[model samples]
Target: MKPIPVTQKLSVAAQLQPDDFQELSRLGFKTVINNRPDGEEASQPGTDAEAAAAKAAGLDYVFIPVTSSSMTDSDVRRFAEAIVASDGPVLAHCRSGARSFYMWVLAGDVDVQGFSDDKLVAVASNIGIAPDASRAWLATHRRTGKPDVKGFYDSRTGSIQYVVSDPTTKRCAIIDPVLDYDEKSATTKTEHADEILGYVTDEGLTVEWILDTHPHADHFSAARYLKEKTGAPTAIGAHVVDVQALWKDIYNWPDFPADGSQWDRLFNEGDTFKVGTIDARVMFSPGHTLASITYVIGEAAFVHDTLFVPDSGTARADFPGGSARVLWKSIQDILALPDQTRIFTGHDYQPGGRKALWESTVAVQKHSNPHIAGQTEESFVALREARDATLPMPKLILHALQVNINGGRLPEPESNGRRYLKIPLDALEGAAW
Candidate 1:
């Protein structure tokens, strides 16, 4: 049997023979799990014979036979228990190795702490194996202490602002809050920020952080305003410096500080923080923007700009420093999260005039997103590039970036006591006419 290593401790193989048991023992496998049912094929070896061979070969053996239609939660738990009880490495086998691979995938749902979702997807992709029951498995499993998510849709900008809170502690964070701007009159207001503040006050929530997933292009960020009102620290991805550098030149501001010092905190990938008792982490997801990030708080992930509603496909990747291929990889990384993990999109177009939606599970995105379900990296890049070429830049990109890059602070007032935005003409060329 040719064994395929799924992880450092687990390997899978097509039905093992009696002779192969000794080889497996010599190869340091401490346990053998049979995922194949007996007597389905007359030529197949029975579990009893396999068990005896494994015993004689000085290896522990367990039979957890699973059929395509008969695999259940109990079977997955037993598989996880067997692995946990094993002394060393484990070698599981099934008719064609696919069943064992799937069993391992399902086992992860029961043993989330024992497995890394990214590692599982990486090995599964390497072996050309994918779980068919991922959605069903996630639907039945529940993770405790999931954060409460509330989405506030801004129809004018089509951006979704969020307040993710730990229900037990009543501590919350405002994510991607919008600073209302009316370009026609060149007026800015705190209507959206006040609405979020009202929710926090009504719910008796304490604001611990004001987080921005990225420097948004469509609307100005209310991060600075919220911080001043709440006295909470403001933060964004550390890569904001790169974006600041690129935009600083575009704006022709030589005195601009591009060191990402404007914000109270700059989070790197894998940086961990807390909102009350809830654990949160950062994942750098750059494609639609150079500094885009996803804040993974408990079961909810604030994936800003990289992914929109599945029906809306992904975001445009033709912005400065954006790459379609890079965006595809970032999308895959988000999809690799646990199927039950809640995916919170930053914006939704409400395609076909449906009500706005910002919440989806990783399972839904995996199975339903048109941009991801059937498209490979090469095809997705081609599609993204072709589509982006036909779309014009956001209306407020020039107006928003100046304020956003400076940590959502409006320009200093002149001696006349009035502030103004600096718009660079023809800076973004080749945009759709």
Candidate 2:
């Protein structure tokens, strides 16, 4: 079976491809669930073909097509039964990977008595999905008192990096990690990444993937550094090609490559992958940047640099290639998630004399975020444009973009055979404003 390209935190058999059953059998996924319905206006490889392939691959296959607007209790029950009866790890997939993920949450906690209340709410939050009526349904029906996993947050970076593991599975993946840097020295450090690495090593967790949400402009992406230390493959959103192009011209680097082939794997929206027991999917979320993406690990959405702490409001959209209108639309999609969904932001700049804080619920952002709360599209556009106009470029804008666009590697060696960075003469006269 060909390996499907999933989101960052999840792991899939390397040989598995979309609708590839033979490889799936070889890789030991005993069951396959096609969450995508047939006959949508969009062209898709039909479910029938996948079903036929699954059968040929000697795997139990089920088709539980779900529409975007409608997923019912009966659907949840059927999905749960399939999971319980499956002989081995299961593969569930759908368009944009969200529907399949929603189903996973539904099935994972279907037996709890308050499935519609507490358990469901907790699971959705754990996996970064917004809590809503659907989550309430799972919480109301939840039969288990103990959560399947636990989660934690870091206050200083305003990022919610997680350590997800199942005792039974012992499989784990770290998502959207913050690698602290020493700005004064122009050197890099790994205190944050080290903590994650220590946890994985101490707990005997196999680190499969070191992922980033995008080539961030505000904070450095430690994917390359972490990969070197952990021996994990590094990845980012595929649209990073667009970012590379944008910055390439801005820096006027004639020798730089344009196509976004920098990262090891360029994940597209709806892509799915695996870590250990967890399956993750990608949601193409732009606005923060041309390539910003959310990695949905199990039920959590690692929404990097999109929405900040709810009270702090949303991310800035004034960077090169960023559009306020597009950011508004992207945030709308995020807000549409279940209200209880956990939104792990990319970076946090603490305000109000508050301690650095990261992680917030969708409900909080929609209701209290000062910048975009109750803001109409037009109003948000106007506000964002005006605010952006008054803002100064990031202190490390030039340095950050050049390094990030190259997947975090510094410039190649010059004619002197030494890697060096250049500062354009007179590039910033009164431009400091």
Candidate 3:
């Protein structure tokens, strides 16, 4: 079996045959780690046979079975402990070795080396492993990418939507497209979303996915409208359930389903997918909202609500389920991306009355962002909370959330044959305005 070396002392390999224990010992490996759960594959060898062969070959073996689909932080901690207990060089095996590599990456996620998924995939590919087994990992921790990113700014809510296109196949994904609503007259229009649809039509791009970073507070989501217009599926972060639960109590909607049944797909952390040839992944970036996620497509990070650009500082973590301390860590993760990685934020307030801008680089943010540059986590949290306390809640927070939390669909028509939004008095007690 060809072994992929992750480090001088640790290596990963595909399912090792029972007869391969001697070879592992001969290669100077002192311990073997089995990361695959039992019965994962019908043709795979049993752990007992592998353990028996390892014992006969004088190599220590540990069965730390892990399900690739449902890996947890505790699993990573256990794998790290197992590695520490091993003697000399350690060997880990899974169906294709990607899961082992992912574990190592997770164990080192907080380590100083900052091993990202881009680095992991590159190293795995060099060792003859196809590495599709860790698509979820790569998507969330992608280091470098260059998808064609175009932003559409909605003047009403100071929100920015995006149409990310794959250069090769002309397939695209719409991100955070807004459904314009006039709170004054309760008028709903598609002007904001139609602009993006027009761009897709003009470019001859096929709409494959209509994505939302989270149910926006400042604006209604055009996800349902766009899905109907383009015949594409809609998706959002899975933790949006937490947002729905919190809002349901405020609105007193006993019948609201907080199970994330609204969207066609509910993405968990590290989930990966594709838009044409461009690989996209999800990273759960809560704090600004309980379900905020960053879409890492190639080298571009669609960091919604975590950052507002260098001039405007970061997003306010004062909404329901928001945390300033958590937002600080989320911003740190975004800053960890490659220096040159293009960052596309969710909104731009056009501070100083300048033209709206939505693009920046990680390098730019780390060095120049007023909220980030020279600020430690504690300092950033203090600053963010102080600023959040003085800011008014988004004008559309109440009206938008009901529609946004329900996957961008307005509430069903009432007996009068028209939909209406329910506004709870004093529901947001801490709203600055």
Say which candidate scores most in TM-score.
1
**Clash numbers, per candidate:** 0, 58, 2
Ranking according to lDDT, highest score first = 1, 3, 2
Across 1-433, the per-residue lDDT of candidate 1 in tens digits comes to 8789877678889888899999999899999999998998988889999999999999999999998667786787677767766879999989877777777765543223223334555655555555444433322432244667778899999999998887669999999999999999999999999999999999899999999998999999999999999999999999999999999999999999999999999999999999889899999999988999999998778899888767888999998999999999899899888765668889988899988877665765766688998999999999999999999999999999999999999999999999989999999989996
**Between candidates 1 and 2, which one is better according to lDDT?**
1
lDDT, candidate 3, 1-433, per-residue tens? 8888887678889899999999898989999999998897788888998889999999999888887666675676566656655768889889988778777765533112223345666777865556684554565543224466678888777898999887668899999989889999999998988889888999899999999999899999999999999999999999999999999999999999999999999999999999888888999899999999999987778999999777898998999899999988888888887665667899988888988877766755776688998898889888988888999988888899999999999999999999989999999896787
Give per-residue CA lDDT, model 2, range 1-433, as digits (tens). 2333222222122112445677666766788877777777455667767777777778888888887567775676566556545767676666545566566554443222112345445544444447785454444433222122333344533455666554446676666666565557766677777887887787787767777787765455566777788777778889988898877777788878867666678899999987675677888888878998887765556787778876667777877667889888888887876554556666666677765555555555665677767799999889878877777766666666777888767667889987665545544334427
By summed lDDT, the worst window of 10 consecutive residues in model 1 runs over 108-117
TM-score (all chains, Cα) for each model: 0.69, 0.62, 0.67
* lDDT for 183 (candidate 1): 99
Residue pairs that clash (backbone atoms under 3 angstroms), model 3: 145-298, 145-299
**Which residue runs of candidate 1 sit more than 4 Å off their true CA positions?**
1-143
Error of 2 at 36 (Å): 39
